[model samples]
Target: MKRNICWIVLLLVLAGCSSPPPIPYEAPTLSFTLNLPDYADESVKNSELQDALVQRGLVLDRFGRIVPLDEGSCLYPIATRTALLKELEQYQSSSFGYTLVSLKKQGDDYFFFPNDSRSQTLESLTLSFDSVLFDLTSIDKGTLVRDWTTHFAYLDQTLLVTGEQHKLLKKKHLSFALRNILIVTGQRASTVGELSMQFVDAIDTTRFLVLTHGDVLRSCQALTQGTMISTPTEPYSRESIKSQVKLVSLLPADADFNQLKQQQSLLSTGRYLTYRGDIATLIDRCSAGQGQSNQALCHSKADDSSARKKKVIVFGGKHGA
Candidate 1:
């Protein structure tokens, strides 16, 4: 009986020494919806906007009832992860101060380099939408063991970001803007990962010339349909087609006066303005680039007021300028 007790004790000790099984990882799927108010104009509201969306095959729920647009805006959930990510990527790239970091997914893990020593596992990164806090504890240490190049990893899961969640994202975006850091997040194998990069070595700037009304007319006359620059306008009569014209801010490129003049001459034949600033500054100004009332506010901090009056043509790439 004493011998049997010793053997049982030994077995219990061995069992206690063994590591516990890892928590079952449930891959997360992120869902998103379109903010109807963001797409709505004065004329397109309530049932009218719903009907238009329905015509476009964006009916909501099962009953085919129109998605309400009240309380800020209503969102229509997007089905494909690819399309949702693409739109989110575009918004991040276009928004001032925010930049998307490239991530590599191998099997059930996603990885990205920190590019800065300050960033670490879950301490420096977080992904939250609305009240839901995603699980990031499933980090793969093999990424660190195999190579020190990858700074972080997360188990694959799907992440859903509804329109309500977007408000939270915008708040986080504002936080990033204030901190002067690049925060990027993506949904992968049932998981969402957020990475912050502290250092950026390069950014590329691309330029486009804004053509004036006369310049547009002149170009239309000389250029063929294929080469002509078309400007979209709102309709006053008949069926209204979507307008291609979009408002964007222009920043002057880092070039000599002569080069700027030469490019202006080549691209435009009418009066125009030049903008020269970083991405963050440009976005801050352009957010207010609507209505006559906001025009003054947009131009309040301009380097030159004369240039602010002219229409803007957006220029510059996302990173490395």
Candidate 2:
């Protein structure tokens, strides 16, 4: 049953450990743990716990820690073990502070290498996350190895870690969060005469890379497209995403349609992703070019989504070594 404010207040008053953890830092980790109030009685703890468990798709671990088990919304934990055990796998997911990040996985660890728009190849800057370090095989239903997505799934307030407790997370190179990031988006057309979306990485203005879905315009039409951008999954609200990512449109609100068609944009010139390497490249089954069309723009009406029309498999587009 959902707990009302009164009940929550009552629990806080009655519980031995009422203080909740600090808001979690936005980073990938082994897994996120839920904070449970130590009620004065087992009956109260058990009753209030169910609401958090089902809402966040969490289960109690042997340690009495609430964790995501068989969570469909977040597959980071089981995505690896369930896939045919390939020697190499790629994980593409939205990051906190970053628009999108892809960690290359070989065996058991995933890694992140921060690079600029000029990144020609994907490299590892830090070992971001890996599930193998934890031996969950002994825990009941904890058989699947876990990663950082569990805590970030829905901005679960119960997962925040404050005080010295933040040190508990094993996230490496925490300074990487301080890196400057830029959000770039542009238009690309498709073979079907549809203006399917694609990403543009401006090597000049861009200090580091991140993608905004459309830079959507009247001339833009994303029939069915997917790219590594600042788009969110179903569990996220635009407000929540906006809080962490900063997006700027290459095409301004007062952009001239004719000038855009003539290869002009707010960048004061055209910026295109003409890379043959890996990082943030496009699998864009789309033809390259831009110009706004009222008809085409209104069809899909401009969205910052990973995939337009449908949310299918979106790769990080990490090409070569």
Candidate 3:
């Protein structure tokens, strides 16, 4: 009888050891500040700026109400205005004016909308859970139907996450991590559009995830390619490779709207695989290629113009002769 009891106890212990750890729970609070130039007093620019600020999740009141802003009442949560004002005093830029509005976390369950307020909710979707993974696949598909502004394309379907994948991410020391793959299907109308996947750090509440859609796509292709190739010296037939090598090449080197839109069309249906890792590395990679492409486009455009001008001069001389 004692032997049976001991065996039962050992089984319970082993089962407990194999179970996943419980996720910590804490309701998230939202806070942010908007800065507008003081010169924006009742001007059309000022009104536009206010609208822009509100669009980026700065319209919550202390009572958790989404309200319109008055000229001086642009401050949300109203409690952090003094701190924001103090922080703004350190600004040295003398370029254009800015109006400063800051969001302060007043209570639990209040969430800020960084994207479109009309599409996103003002309350925390992850409420009542400390660490949870929210699946975005469905939400993204639905949003695409309602919002014509987004362009999406399918590169390939990948398993969302596996036990091994979760273990890999956890080994990298990320908590409260979430992952999703979103395809930019339609063409982007503007050159300024960017794809960013960021997660708010549970410890410090700082958001991190700096890779662009291009960066992520290239990384995925390279990794998958390397895995399929058996040797470094092996020659790859272009047709055998399933990767879209031309998609990312179309990203504009400059900020020309027409050129940007044209290039974005090429990115339509490109596959981007998402991964979670060290925040510092992601930030470094994002900053490294920030404007290099745009600058290259500018230089290329200059060269073309110079060549055209020389041609015009030569044609005029030939006609005069």
Candidate 4:
């Protein structure tokens, strides 16, 4: 997040005695002052009007971190209005805008409208406690979407989004999104994840895939404590192999391999499989067992080693590892 010291300085400049003088008061437990006047929207001062800004997580301090309390919300600086407007204009250079029309929120159910119009909605559809804001919509309703104008400093205007409904807004997706914005703003891919080790390459926004494993995993781990990311790699392959390929031995203890079997059946019927989605086939292909007892053992150390060698030769070492 970018910091604008101008807000603090502007507050100092404006601090002084009024005609009748102001009532003295201590700072609130939670407080924030806005740094940009033009964008802060003075109309927000109305006591009776309620804005979705807070619920949507739009409240921010000059430092760009979310302000948790009402007292922390402040107006953008009046002095910097011109500069703020200029920045906003630059941010709004693109003609496209997005309107997110969400379905009514129940206890925890979430839903979004599938529309071909420029507008789209993000629903909070969670099926289980582990589900993170998952939802679904028909693909035909997808339309062209762009980054939020209010978040320009954190993203770029050139970053385009394909119309698709997704359940998990995983950190990898957010990181890639940030990288696209930074690339458009001419900044180095701001290092993502807690440790800030994984750097995204901003060549084409559309071509950039999210980082879910390896360095990406390290980055996410660094950012938040007790966060575990899925790291199953290359589970399926279409190419016939003369040698074997390595599979991750450390599977999640509670992982639903049964759920995987269901997906595998779907893949066999017609669904596409990423390398991570082909676990059963990859294991079967790399093993030598024919009987139930032999298959229970799954593979031998020698087979595992051969598979690693084949993977290094076929998919290249960087990702195969």
Candidate 5:
């Protein structure tokens, strides 16, 4: 994922952000809980369901939510926003994964809308949590068949979403949906148990896949503990930061999106994406200016065209403001 950070920075910058103050943002917690529908079994509750999840390569995190253990049956992807988006973009770029719709969360469920980078016009669908995995298209079929502008989502747009909805996914981070074949039908319990090690990538809070081997049950604990980052702290170098900040936005079209799905390569890739996301955050501050609270303004996508081009620092590994 470190190797791919260069491209991701570009993707985010190119993707853009909207207007907001430079005040510090408490990192959004990606921790989630699986909400069982009325029809699913009720017996998989509390300890009984927890025990079943444990048998199936899962464990309760410190936050008391169920997360995947690093065993051969499940994977837990923990990374920052930049790395996660890059992995999502690169997964498709490397011919390993493809971008599904960005997720729109309403109440307990997530709906799919076309917000992919290529900006294609595609079909919309809803996603639901079955005990073990996510179903890409919903029986509900097409969602809110309305104006296209309302459906298209972007990562940094924060504004009021009006009328008729409970809650919409305001932050435009990527959602990694399941299409990988490692956890297959019929051989599900057996094949999936063995294929967990190869998992790469993740699903955002919406449509997170939770597999319950023994259970009715259903949980994020990984994130950097920091506030308002500007430059590399004592241990790191400016040279490393600049190289990562430069965006090299090209990705191969030949790769299939499936390669990064369902235990494809290594969790190390997910870690790499998180690293990039943190660096992306760092650049937002460093470019805003050293020690100035408004330094985050340097990278805000909502800024005008001239502002977008005025990055305070230069890249290609040189170190000077």
Candidate 6:
């Protein structure tokens, strides 16, 4: 009797339950535009700088998307990476004082001699950090490596001699310190593995170096470049840099036109990437040489837009190194 009563209740409950609504499906459409900063363009020309950028995976299409273009069939990723690195170099140099200390393009990997001795000092500091802090490996291997080092050094006289005042330094300088760690370590990491792997290796290596180096006067050529150029006085704005980087190309990634258009709606929105200078000079130069529409002025349109289009202007932040 109890079993029968339970079955009747279950049937009533089952009959009362309603079916769920179907999920709506929309096509996955990609839509975004990206550009290279001025320095990234220049760095692409330098084989060494290009390698550094490739290692970091910063070289992407106009949409800020990375697509490995290793084969000869596709060179857009290669070109985009090279160009973006060149453009980024300006900001790196101006903001952080990175100079072309030395650049040499090896076979697939480029060997860079940044001329900054922070690596040496970091090597030493890593040793010191190892000495003072116990069980630091937990944080050392983790993302906190950079943060801990900056905090530890600022609190302790790790970077300065015993007599020097550590309290005077603000924590803000830690970011710069962290940047130095990345550059030095990232350069070293670029040597052992593929481009992307190398970038990570460099970062990992920097953690060890930052921990080991105690207080040493490292080479400041990179830093000096910033000072000489008065980069700090002008200061590089991250937002402005991001904006300028967004303007390099309409379709900056590694994809066919259809693929790129599918990824970026602006490409289909009737936008083109053109250099203002190129457009301004195209008419005069074309009239003097070739008057055909299919000739000089034709290529002058930025990417695909006409010269008269209202443009988003970007200012060069600084000129360091």
| Shift of residue 82 alpha carbon in model 5, Å | 26
Tens-place lDDT digits, model 2, residues 1-321: 456888888887878476665555443323322343331112445534433232322333333333232222221111112111121122222111112334333344433323423211121222233221111112222111133333122221112121122232223212212112112232322232222333323223432221223222211212212111112112222232232111121222222212222222212222322111111222111112332343244223324221222333433343232
TM-score of 3: 0.16
* Model 4 C-alpha lDDT per residue in residues 1-321, reported as the tens digit of each score: 124688776666677432445555433343333232222333444211112222221222322222222321211100011112232233232111111112322233323333433212231111111111111121221221122222222422223222231112232243334443212122323343222222222343443222222222222223332123222222233331211111122122112222334444443433422222333322332234435554443334323433322222232223111
Worst 10-residue lDDT window, candidate 4: 74-83
Stretches of candidate 6 off by over 4 Å are: 1-91, 94-303, 306-309, 312-321
RMSD of each: 30.5, 26.5, 31.8, 27.9, 27.6, 22.4
lDDT of each: 0.27, 0.26, 0.27, 0.26, 0.26, 0.26
- Candidate 3 residue spans exceeding 4 A from truth: 1-110, 114-122, 128-214, 217-234, 238-321
Per-residue lDDT of 101 in model 1: 32
TM-scores vs. true structure, each candidate:
0.18, 0.17, 0.16, 0.17, 0.16, 0.18
Q: By summed lDDT, which 10 consecutive residues of candidate 1 come out lowest?
A: 72-81
True-vs-predicted CA distance for residue 151, candidate 1, Å: 8.6
Query: Which pairs clash in model 2?
Result: 22-162, 113-125, 189-287, 218-293, 219-292, 219-293
lDDT string for model 3 (203-313, tens) is 222322221222222222222321211111111222312322221122211111112233333334331222221111111111235466644543454334323112221
What is the lDDT, from 0 to 100, of the residue 118 in candidate 4?
Answer: 29
lDDT of residue 253 for candidate 6: 21
Q: For model 1, give the RMSD to the true fold.
A: 30.5
Alpha-carbon deviation at 95 in model 3, angstroms: 40
